[model samples]
Target: MTYRGRFAPTPSGDLHRGSLLTAVASYLDARQADGAWHLRIDDIDPPREVPGAADRIQQQLAAHALHWDGSVQYQSQRHDAYAAAVDMLLASGHAFYCALSRRQLADLGGRHPGPAVAVSPASHSATNTNPNPNTDCAIRLAVPDTPICFTDRLQGRQCLSLGEADGAFVIRRRDKLYAYQLACALDDADQGMTHILRGADLMDSTLRQVHVLDCLGRTRPDYGHLPVLTDSDGNKLSKSAGAAALSPDTSANLYGALRLLALDPPADLAGAPCAEQLAWAIPQWQPARLNNTLTFGVADAP
Candidate 1:
């Protein structure tokens, strides 16, 4: 338990500014803590993954000098592992198949995929409403009645009952794809990741992941959800918003990412070499100094 950490990025596009900021922060945090950091490419969904995007992502990480200690972990090669996880959950009785379609489930409970809106007194923790025999539904974890709570290194002392966050969402989709909740939880545990640093957009998802960990009899890890990278109009940084992709060839690109993470670069080395700048940044990095706001930028990452 030497402060293991990881940065798992989806290879749907080039490394936009937001992603760069996350990697730099995670890299510096691990280096500063004198811990090991691992990189895991979340390329489970092949259709959504862009061609050559994964290679480009690694190229960009190299450009940023955000080197990981061990061999990279790719989710694409882990389907058999995911299958084993799914089978294990099914056998343990902690997970079950649900035939409730989007429409039927939403009609009864506001929105099918939204945060737990109105807790059903009748259905809360009751196994009777488990998917009816006729309908085809996704597998959902049976979250306990107790609140799923954790202390975020940045946000701090958060709490939410299992039903409060998407009331029993799918771990295995109807399309047979692994839900991010189950996959990420299992991967984090398998890799011994004690510190998770990522975007604030995943804050809600963390609740479900925690429940999955509990169901698997695993302990939750420390977390730091950085603010969303947004556009000038205040939209979160994304391809839809047209954020600038990281320029691997551009000078001082990594420094800009560090600045976004709120790590103060030493003034003398403001224009110092990448290694030197990173050397200064790692020691100054602290998760508590970050903001939890849903960040957005107009054109580039801020």
Candidate 2:
């Protein structure tokens, strides 16, 4: 199969140092393999997306010369596709509606560590009067009671016991938005993405996605979850923490992000033009140079 990779961004804010690293890693890997690199803007959750953030993200990525191939894809425009997939799964008996309340799951002796959220197979409630899946009512994949395992391209062989982590999980939401596990699998398959480059924070989600793909009878793609960039205080650079947005005028932030991921860019990069620096850095991308740890703090950067 052709090597196809992608940099999927959720436009909740501008690209942060951490996000740039992810974009850089994916971009370089695709280029190195002479593969296609696609861009997908995950804007399905409009309620969470920030105003003008998507446009600003595109502008910043262009400024840094992290160009992508083909037309950009926006998830909001693909709701019908997600709906169709959900319907197919429902009809095929590979998925079913779940009605577990947050409070009940929360009290499940404690939150399950991995991705699968356990719901009793015998515990489902679908009334004729309220047939619509609730945002709280999610579609859970009916994964076989087996071990979900994969060899991480960067971290090596790994395994997650579905029964231990999270049991079957939500594929569709009560709120009508398709769940991430479901939507991502369908989108990746449709986009012909064979290599997935994302952050280690999503490791748990990977097992969940793999489980969902298995149930849907789809191919599981190769994955490389890079080290997560953390804040000065050691918290991961998440939107909730307001990671500093990328500035078109500065490659310092972007370079710092690469460093945080342990990419040893050329020494002259600090003064080189952003385009020149990126041109030099892309081919030098090395996934093995990065530590297998889940997170990286600013202090960790050289």
- Cα distance off (Å), candidate 2, residue 191: 0.3
For candidate 2, give the lDDT. Answer: 0.76
lDDT accuracy of residue 279 in candidate 2: 75
Give per-model TM-scores: 0.86, 0.87
Best by TM-score: 2
The residue-level lDDT of candidate 1 at 91 comes to: 91
| 39-107: candidate 1 lDDT, tens digit per residue | 999987777788998898887787666788789999888788788887888799777776555555766
**Full-model lDDT for every candidate:** 0.74, 0.76
